[model samples]
Target: MKRKATAVWKGAGKTGKGTLSTQSGVLKDSNYGFSSRFEDGEGTNPEELVGAAHAGCFSMKLAFVLQENDFEAEEINTESQVILEDGAIKEVFLITKVKVAGLENDKFTEMVNDAKDNCPISKLLDAKINLEAELL
Candidate 1:
C-alpha cells in the first residue's frame, strides 16, 4: 500500500507561506508559514504533523506487539518530539507511557523495543530515535 501527502508553497523561504494536504483529508490546505514553522503562529507545521504520525504509528506497533506477547494494554500514550537543527530534522524522541497489567519490567521493555524498531515511521526516519516506556 502507498500513502501520499502534498505540500504547496508560495514565495521564498523564510518569508514563504504554504498549505499541506493529506490523502486522508485530515489536513486540507492547512496553513503553514515561516512564523508557524519557525516562530509562534496559530497554525500547523511540518514537525508537528510528523510528530502526530510518529505517535500514531508507534502506538499501533505497540498494540500489535503486546497482542502477540499475550499481553494487553489499557492505553499507550506516546509523545514524539522532533528536533530541527541546521535546517534539517535531526532527531525524534519518543516518550511513552504504557498502561498495562500482568507484565514484568523486562517483558515490558522488550515489547517497547520491538515496537520502536518495528514502527513504520521509525523505520522510515533517518534521525536518531529514543524511547521511554512505563507501565501503570
Candidate 2:
C-alpha cells in the first residue's frame, strides 16, 4: 500500500525548472518551477497538488463515514487551501459543502470532523488543519 512520485530539477533558484511524475502517469512529466510555485505560471505547483490530495482524501473518507452510518449524500464538494508562510507550509484549510437529504446537522458535523481527523492525508500532514463544512 505504498505509492511513489518523482521530481527532477535542473539548475538553481528562481530560474530553475523541474518535472513532476507519478507512478500512475496522472502527472507524467508535468512542468513545475519557481515561477509555477511562486508566481502566476502555466503549470502546476506542489501546494496545489497537496491541496488536491487533501480534498480528495477528505471527501472519500467522509463518503465512507456516511455510508457506514446508513446515510447518503447527493454531492460533496471540498476545497483545500495550503498556506505557505516563512518558506514553509503552515496550515491546511479544508472547506466542504454537502448536499444530503434527511441528515441531522449534528451527525453530519460529527462525521465531517471524523473524516478530517482520520483521513490518511490529514494524518500525514504536519501542519495545522482546519475544516469548515456546510450543508446545502
Candidate 3:
C-alpha cells in the first residue's frame, strides 16, 4: 500500500531544475522547473501530476461505488483542476461526465458526491474541493 516518487533538484530556486521519477517507471527522470510550474514551459509540473492523480482516484472510486450499489458504469471521465494561490494549493475542482444505465439522476449525484468525499486523495487534500458531475 505504499508508492514512491523521487525528485532531484539542482541549482537555486528560480532557475533550478528537477527530475521526477516514480517507482512504477512511468515517469523516469521527468523534468520540471520554475517556468514549467509557474508559467508556460515545456515540461511536466507537480500540480499537473496532482490533477491527474486526483482525476484517476475520483473516477475509480465512483466506479467502485456504482458497482457496490448493484450498478455498473458504462464510462466515467473526470477532469481535476488544481488551483494554487500564494504558493499554496487553494482548491481542486473535479468535473465528471458519467454514463450509466438504469440509474436515476438523483442517485448518480449522490454517488458522485460520496465518491468525491470518500476518495483517498480527496480525503488527503486540505483544500476546498468542488465537484460538477454530469450524468449522460
Best candidate according to lDDT: 3
Better of 2 and 3 by TM-score: 3
Model 3: runs farther than 4 Å from truth? none
Best by TM-score: 3
Task: Note each model's CA RMSD in angstroms.
Answer: 1.0, 0.9, 0.6
lDDT of 3 by residue, 26-72 (tens): 99999999999999998999999999999999999999999999999
Whichever of 1 and 3 has more TM-score, that candidate is 3
- Candidate 1's displacement at residue 16, Å, is 1.8
Superposed model 1: Cα runs more than 4 Å off? none
Predicted candidate 1 versus true structure: per-residue lDDT over 1-136, tens digit per residue: 9889999999998888899999999889999998998889878998998899999999999999999999888999999999988988889999999998899999899999999999999999889999888888
Runs of candidate 2 exceeding 4 Å displacement: none
RMSD over all Cα atoms, model 3 = 0.6
- What lDDT would each prediction earn against the true structure? 0.92, 0.94, 0.96
Q: What is the TM-score of each candidate against the true structure?
A: 0.95, 0.96, 0.98
